[model samples]
Target: MDRPLVAVGSVIFNGDSVLLIRRLHPPNQYKWAIPGGKVELGERLRDAVIRETLEETGLLVEPRTLMGIIEVFKEGYHYVILDFICEKKGGELKASSDAGDAKYFTLNEIRKLNVSSTTLEMLERFWRGEKMPFMITEISK
Candidate 1:
């Protein structure tokens, strides 16, 4: 793509578990990651996160805090992703849209899954309850 796409992702939490989805699309196809997708033109970041989460995981969530920003570049495509810590509001858990599977996992369970390095770092911060300081990460596939 010519320009970087703006995307939003949510690290939805309920107690000690967090939401994860097995992506059915490229960039991380078949791999587990937080629910999210590209932000539509004129859409707010918070709205994008909520919409993406619902589209991928069938969950309605309320974004609580912004976790951080990640910049990913691979094969001529670039994306600037904003990640948020969200709380479950309502809706059933099921895979939909770009997700092949959607489920909740404890931190220990997440450690054993096939996930992106960026996601791992974000999870670590979330688990520790670290006060994220608007971090910017770059990932190259």
Candidate 2:
């Protein structure tokens, strides 16, 4: 890894469910996580989150709130991820880009899947009615 890359993720909720994608790339391959990717140069954080969500899950999203930051370090890769709460504005749900699968899951169902810890923790926090802008650090061995 070179310098830490900046990325953005969106947490879209529908009633009691949350949207997740199965990653097709390394660092967390095959793990269910929020739709996201590294930001392109000069792109705004909110735009990156919206674009990434659409690219990965085929859902057009409108970012509603800044959820928090997640700093991840694993396998020599580092990412500073800005997470946001997003609302689905349009488009159908389907896997594309670096996502192998995409779907909405209730918290109970999510606990049974191969979900990223960071994602699981965040959802748990959200469900518990915890405060926003939670800070998280994930260092994988």
Candidate 3:
């Protein structure tokens, strides 16, 4: 990688559950996380969130609010991720794109799964109704 890449992701809620995808690639492959990917060139951040969610989870979503930002550095990978809390619109839910699996998980279920650290922290802060646009930094070997 040359420069810090910008990515967008969504935290979608269906009733009391949140949607998540098991990534099929690193920097956190095979672990459940929010559905999103790298933003495309000239794409608006909100548009990227919507598109990424659809691409990974097979569900259409509308971005509701900017939850926070997470910067991750691990194994020679760096990603500055903007996460939005979104409202589910429509479309059947399935795993696609770089997602090995997709599903809605309750908070209880989430705590039991092998989730990306950023996802866990973001969701925890969100559930606590913390301030918006918070920042999280995670570095791993």
Candidate 4:
């Protein structure tokens, strides 16, 4: 059986500001989520995260720590996303057509925004250096 997992990163800054995007797809349309995609074959996890962020959000990133891991069951597939806490290296940040728009936000503001439940939980666990386990959670259909 496959591990059914992939590593993901969330670039955050200033203790409260996190990089978010407005997705332009079926899964997360109009919701503010982290600027990351999937881990590519033969690519390093760090490279994948940075590349995905750049491609999706136009921001160069340097992930600092492994925040936590989250398992999501969505759209008839299981995904394990390794959430990384990151900092910006350098880039002129903008939103790609893949993601509607990119911006930074405070913790309170992000909490009020339409963020995915898993994303919010990941941030919460990561903030306290707590560990999360592999478990199933149904996604919004």
Q: Pick the candidate with the highest TM-score.
A: 2
RMSDs, each prediction? 1.5, 0.9, 1.1, 3.0
lDDT of each: 0.85, 0.90, 0.90, 0.73
| True lDDT of residue 44, candidate 2 | 90
* TM-score-superior candidate, 3 or 4: 3
lDDT of 2 by residue, 1-141 (tens): 669999999999989999999999977899999999999999998889889998999999999988878899987889998889998999999999999999899999999999988888988887888866988999987
Question: Which window of ten consecutive residues has the lowest lDDT sum in model 1?
Answer: 132-141
Better of 1 and 2 by TM-score: 2
Ranking by lDDT: 2, 3, 1, 4
Please count the clashing residue pairs in each candidate, in the order shown. 0, 0, 0, 0
lDDT by residue (tens digit), candidate 3, 7-121: 9989888788998999999878889999999998999998999899888888999998889999999879889999998888998998999999998998889999999877988
Better of 1 and 3 by TM-score: 3
- Clashing pairs in model 3? none
TM-score of each prediction: 0.92, 0.96, 0.95, 0.82
Clashing pairs in 4: none
Q: Across residues 24-112, which tens digit of lDDT does each residue of candidate 4 receive?
A: 87455688887777788898988888888889877788877776666776655567776677787888888995799888887778789
The deviation in Å at residue 111 for candidate 3 is: 1.3
